[model samples]
Target: MMDQLLLALQGLRRSRVWLSIFRREQLPQTEADWLAMNRRNFFVHILPAKIHKGSTRLSYNWIWMGVISTWLFVILTITGLFLMFYFVPSVERAYDSIKEIMNSVTLGRFMRNMHRWAANLMVFAVFLHMMRVFWTGSYQKPREFNWVIGVLLFVVTVLFAFSGYIVPWDQLGYYAAKIASNIADGVPYIGPQVKQILLGGTDLQQPSLLRWYVIHVFFLPLVIVLLIGIHFWRIRKDDYSKPVEYERGRRD
Candidate 1:
């Protein structure tokens, strides 16, 4: 019975359906095999088959701020989704909804706090990552476009925080939105139109709150996600930027 069961399991493993999903049934045993596996594997295709030794060093990347930022975004997305279930976007109930989440919902306070902190930390991490890239001269040569994208991502990250800031519709949120609109109003020719479009009217009201809520929960998230996908693809295509020493040597 045991022999028959073992044979059955082996047969299953060798089946076409299993082969289609697993790609390689056996673990790679050699360096070449590992390289090929990395090239062929869909899940890891975004990563290069090999990496620079310097890229792995702490001083070069400053504790992998990019990775930390990405993980923080993941945390924010998860906790934000959970909080969304209990969050009412209506102006009348928005603040009370937050109170309810904090006081009544299970794990609600934790999720909200997690979402808030992750959002804050992601902004900080992305800033540090960008600074590291700049100071290391990673923005030179073929990487100039990626640097532009990084700058755009930084702007969007700030917008993400700003949009989310106004969702609760409390005094702080109200003033924040007011201040943002006031800033928009200072942008010269397009300022008034921009403020009008953003607030959906002349002042901060239900329409403004609703607009920001949609942007915070939907539009900005979608935009940032697409940008991140392109950013990672660009990194893979361009390869990780060389360490400062290697870069300088190549130029010299």
Candidate 2:
């Protein structure tokens, strides 16, 4: 994945994709080396020579952030699959299956809670880590594209929340769906059309349940996986990010 990202960027960089905006000499590297980065940027370009070679290996923290997010995604997938065993999309059966999971399925209650909490924590952690990266200027210069990738990851996190919100089928979930559908209906000229597509009519009913389930169980997860691949690829392509100056060598 990282090799692919590098190759893509290598093409872009060679073509001087940011020529008009960032300018040739504005970047700290020699233009020829960047022509295809067939010439690699030396450590001297970004770091002092005194640092040991091993210090530049990898960021265990960023890798761990990705690992934790990946783990949460796997947990959500497994728990969601188990929940599907009992779940029915009909409004009547939706809430009942939730109750059944809570009461009847062995350890279902704990699994549900753990899945839910992990999801919430994953969002929070991603936000905090993103903020940390931003404040540290991890998104600078050659890394601007990866910063865009980071923003997309944030969007995927929200997508997960929106898709997962409808699973319980309680009064709260029902109303939440209604409100969300109404927002979908507010998409300017396409508002009503979007609502019609999502709701399958003017009101929430069977079609709405099915639509949300398809997005939740299949479509959105596939998109998330694609975005994750891009995210990890960017990390490797740009090389590990540098910690903030104040936090440098502090064991982040």
Candidate number with greatest TM-score: 1
Tens-place lDDT per residue, model 1, 121-145, is 9999999999999999998878888
lDDT of 2 by residue, 80-166 (tens): 788788778887788888888889999889888877887887787778768757766777766789888878888888778876788
Listed per model in order, the count of residue pairs whose N, CA or C atoms clash below 3 Å is: 0, 0
Question: Which pairs of residues have clashing backbones in candidate 1?
Answer: none
TM-scores, all candidates, are 0.92, 0.71
Give candidate 2's whole-model lDDT.
Answer: 0.73
CA lDDT, every prediction?
0.90, 0.73
Give the residue spans of candidate 1 off by over 4 A: 1-9, 249-252
